[model samples]
Target chain A: AQSVTQLDSHVSVSEGTPVLLRCNYSSSYSPSLFWYVQHPNKGLQLLLKYTSAATLVKGINGFEAEFKKSETSFHLTKPSAHMSDAAEYFCVVSDRNGNEKLTFGTGTRLTIIP
Target chain B: GAGVSQTPSNKVTEKGKYVELRCDPISGHTALYWYRQSLGQGPEFLIYFQGTGAADDSGLPNDRFFAVRPEGSVSTLKIQRTERGDSAVYLCASSLMVGGRDEQFFGPGTRLTVL
Candidate 1:
């Protein structure tokens, strides 16, 4: 079985400060990991994905995540947080063996304070 | 539409009633998926279809749920004898192919409320 665990249920950060959302995964095979952000009343938008080619993957709106095998972690980070970045984020994992079913983490609600 | 589309953004139904939710995948997309999300939770996989066949349905919670894609372009999720526990945001996504590396494009989702 494959699953993902998002360490924090909620995270708060002041505007312009750095942000981090932690996630970990357990899969029988090498996994494809992705981070997605969903604004209020909006569909989820892809932030980034790690397909095994690169451990450090960059995404839109200045977001990035690193895949670490030893740690079994794929944590998302941003150098600075903006008010618009406040949203719900999901960490998803899928095995490279073509399972095609993505297992999603519980989710992390991000709040940016002005 | 250029992206995955779902109908009836909001639905309210009474317990014991039947409900049907629809999804339209992107043009030429052969892989379609359905997921359910409750409040404060991430989307949970329910079922997946490749072309006209259901490739995987292991994630469906119970037999009360059923889905179909007759033509491989549009799909519908059907619920029988719905209960309050069935209330959730039903999300639909589609990808160009069925693979681990392919990205799934999501729809806005249908929020279902059971009373």
Candidate 2:
């Protein structure tokens, strides 16, 4: 079984400040990790994914995440926050093989205060 | 190129009514999936299809939930005897191929509210 846990349900950050969203995961196999962002009334958008390649993965919109095997975590970060960055972010996990089902975390809602 | 599209952006039904949600995947994508998101929670996997056959459906809550992809391009999620607990957003996603290596694009989702 594979699962993801997003540490913060809601994260508030000021514009121009660095943003951090913590996530931990558990998987029986070589896990594939992904971060998806959902704007209000919009579809889920793929930010980044880690498939056992480089520990550091870069995504769209200036977002990035590091895959730390030792910590069983894949935390998302941004160098600076923007008003458009405010969205519900979900950390997802899946088996790297044929199990195409994506197990998602409860999600972290990012709120940017201008 | 178009992204995934789902119809009936919002649905309201009484208890025990049957409902069907449609999804039109991106053109030429071979893999399709269904998921459900409840209030204050993440999207939960429901089923997936590779071509016209179901690839996995272990996430389905019960017999009340069923899905089908008739021609391998469009899919539908059918729910029978709906309950208030079934109220949630039904999402459809599709990928280019049949493996986890591909990225899945999601649809805007159909919000189902069971009354």
Candidate 3:
């Protein structure tokens, strides 16, 4: 079975400050990881994905995540936080054996202060 | 140009009643997925369909939950004897492929509230 764990339930950052959301995963095969963001009353939007092509994956809205095989982590980071960055983020993982089903983490709520 | 779409943005039903939710995937997407999200929790996988067949139904909580994608495009999820615990935001997503590397595009989700 595959699973993902988000280290933080909530994270708050001031505008223009750095932001980080930690995540870890356990998978039997080579893992395909992803980050998704959900705004209030909206569906989830894909942020970034790691499919073994690149360790450093860049996403929309200045977001990026590094896939560290050694740490079993794929933590999302932003150089500077914006007010619109406040939303719920999820870490996801899928089995490399062509299993289309994705396992999601509990989620981390991001709050950006002005 | 169309994305995944789900019907009945919100549903309120009494316990013991049956409910059916609908989903329409992108024009050529061959893969569809269903998930349930409770308040303040991550979405839990329910089922996955590849083409006209269910590739995976292991995440289904019980036999009361069932889904079908007969024509390989539109799908329906049926829940029998609805319980309050079944109340949640039911999300539908679709991807270009049935592989792990494909990105899944999501719909607005149907918020089902059981009373």
Candidate 4:
């Protein structure tokens, strides 16, 4: 079975400060991971994904995550937080072996303080 | 269209009524997926369709929920006797299936409220 866990339920960062939201995963096969953000009342948007090619993946809005096999972690980070960054973030995992259905973590709600 | 699209941005229904949500995947994409997101929770997998066939549906909560992709592009999720607990945002996504990367682009979602 494939599953994902977002280590933090909530994370708050002041504007212009660094931000971090941690995630972990478990998969039987080589895993494909992704980070997505959902702004209030809007569609979920893809931030980035790791398909086993590059350990570090960069995404929209100056976000990035490193795929750490040894740690079973795929943590999302940003150099600076903006007020618009306040939203819900999800960590998803899918393996090549099955139908590639995504397994999602509960989610981490990020709060940006001005 | 460039991205996935879903209809009925919001729906309010009485308990036990039936509802149908629609999704239009990105053009030329062969894989489509359905998910449901409750308040404060991440989206949960509901089903997957490869072309015109349902490849996986293990995540469906019960038989009351069903989905179909008739022509391999537009899909509809059907619900029977909707309950209050069934209220959620139904999300649809499509994958290009390029090199098996499986990165899915999502739709705005159909918010269903069962009262």
Candidate 5:
């Protein structure tokens, strides 16, 4: 069984400040992790993915996440926050052995203050 | 060139009625998926299709839910005897045939309201 847990349901950050959205996971097998962003009334967009390559992964729009196997975490981070970055973020995990089913976290809602 | 598209952005129906939602995947994408998302929760997997066959339907809640991808490009999800609990956003996603590394592209999703 594989599951993901997002520590924060909502996070607020001021513009130009650093942003952090924490996520943790439990997987029996080697897992593939992904971060997806969803704006209001829009579809989910892939931000980044980790497939047992580098521990640190960079994504679109200045977002990045570090895969820590020891901690069972893959927390998303950004050096600076922008207004457009306010959205819902989901942490997903899947099996590495060709399992296409993605187990998604409850999601973290990000709010950016001007 | 285009991304995944799902038909009927919104659907409202009375309980016990049947409904069908459709999805058109991106060109050349061989893997399609269906999920249901309730408010304040992440999407729950319903089914997955590889090419024209359903690779996995274990996530489906019950026999009332069925899906078909006759030609491997377009797919349909049919739900029978709808209940108020069935109200949720139905999402469709597609990915290239790259096994575990495929990054899924999602559609806007259909908002179903069961009355």
Candidate 6:
């Protein structure tokens, strides 16, 4: 079974400070990892994805994640946090095989302090 | 141009009632999916459709949950004998194609409240 675990349920960071949201995944095969963000009353938006290509994947809104195979981690990070970055983040995993169903982590709510 | 869209942004129903949620995928998207998200939890997969056929429905919690994607464009999820536990947000997503790397675009989701 492929699954993802988000280390923090909530993360608070001041504006202009660095941000880190940790995630760990478990999969039998080489899995596809993704980070998604959801704002209040909005849909889930794709942040970044790792598909066995480069370990470091950059996404929209100045977000990025690194896939670490040895550590089974794909942590999302940003150099600086903005008030607009406050949202719920989810770490997702899917089988590399054609099955596109995603297994999502509980989620981490990020609060950007202004 | 438009992302996935779901109908009935909010629905209130009583127990033992039947409810149907609709989803319209992006134009030309070949794959659609349904997921349920409870408060304080991530979305849980319910089913997947490729074209007009259901490729996988294993994630459905019970037989009371059923979905159809006829004509390969619009989809509907039907639930029978709704329970209070079934109250949650139902999300729909679509992808250009079914692949490991394909990104699934999500809808705003339909919030179902069972009384």
True contacts kept of each: 0.57, 0.75, 0.75, 0.51, 0.70, 0.75
lDDT of 5 at B18: 100
lDDT by residue for model 4 over B75-97, one digit each (tens)? 99999999999999999999876
Scored against the true structure, residue A20 in model 1 reaches a CA lDDT of 97
DockQ of each: 0.63, 0.71, 0.70, 0.55, 0.69, 0.71
Task: Give the C-alpha miss distance for residue B52 in model 5, angstroms.
Answer: 1.0
TM-score of predicted structure 2: 0.98
Model 4 chain A lDDT-worst window of ten: A94-103
The candidate 4 chain B region of ten consecutive residues with least summed lDDT is B95-104
* Displacement of the residue B106 alpha carbon in candidate 4, Å: 0.7
DockQ-wise, the better of 1 and 4 is: 1
Of the candidates numbered 4 and 6, which has the greater DockQ value? 6
Compared with the true structure, model 6 gives a TM-score of 0.98
lDDT of 3 by residue, B1-115 (tens): 5888999999999999999999999889999999999999999999999999998999999999999998999999999999999999999999888864667999999999999
Model 1: CA > 4 A from native: A97-99
Give Cα-based local distance difference scores for all models. 0.93, 0.94, 0.93, 0.91, 0.94, 0.95
Q: Which digits, one per residue and each the tens of the lDDT, describe model 2 over residues B10-115?
A: 9999999999999999999999999999999999999999999998899899999999998999999999999999999999999988764889999999999999
Worst 10 residues of 3 chain B by lDDT: B95-104
> What C-alpha lDDT does candidate 3 achieve relative to the native structure?
0.93
The list of candidate 5 runs beyond 4 A from truth reads A97-99
Could you give the CAPRI-style class of model 1?
Answer: medium
Chain A TM-score compared with the true chain A, each model in order: 0.96, 0.97, 0.97, 0.96, 0.97, 0.97
For model 4, the docking class works out as medium
lDDT tens digits by residue: candidate 3, A95-114: 86434888899999999999
- Where does candidate 3 stray beyond 4 Å? A97-99
Candidate 6 on B33-77: residue-level lDDT in tens? 999999999999999999999999999999999999889999999
lDDT of candidate 5 at residue A28, scale 0 to 100? 90
**Clash totals for all candidate models:** 0, 0, 0, 0, 0, 0
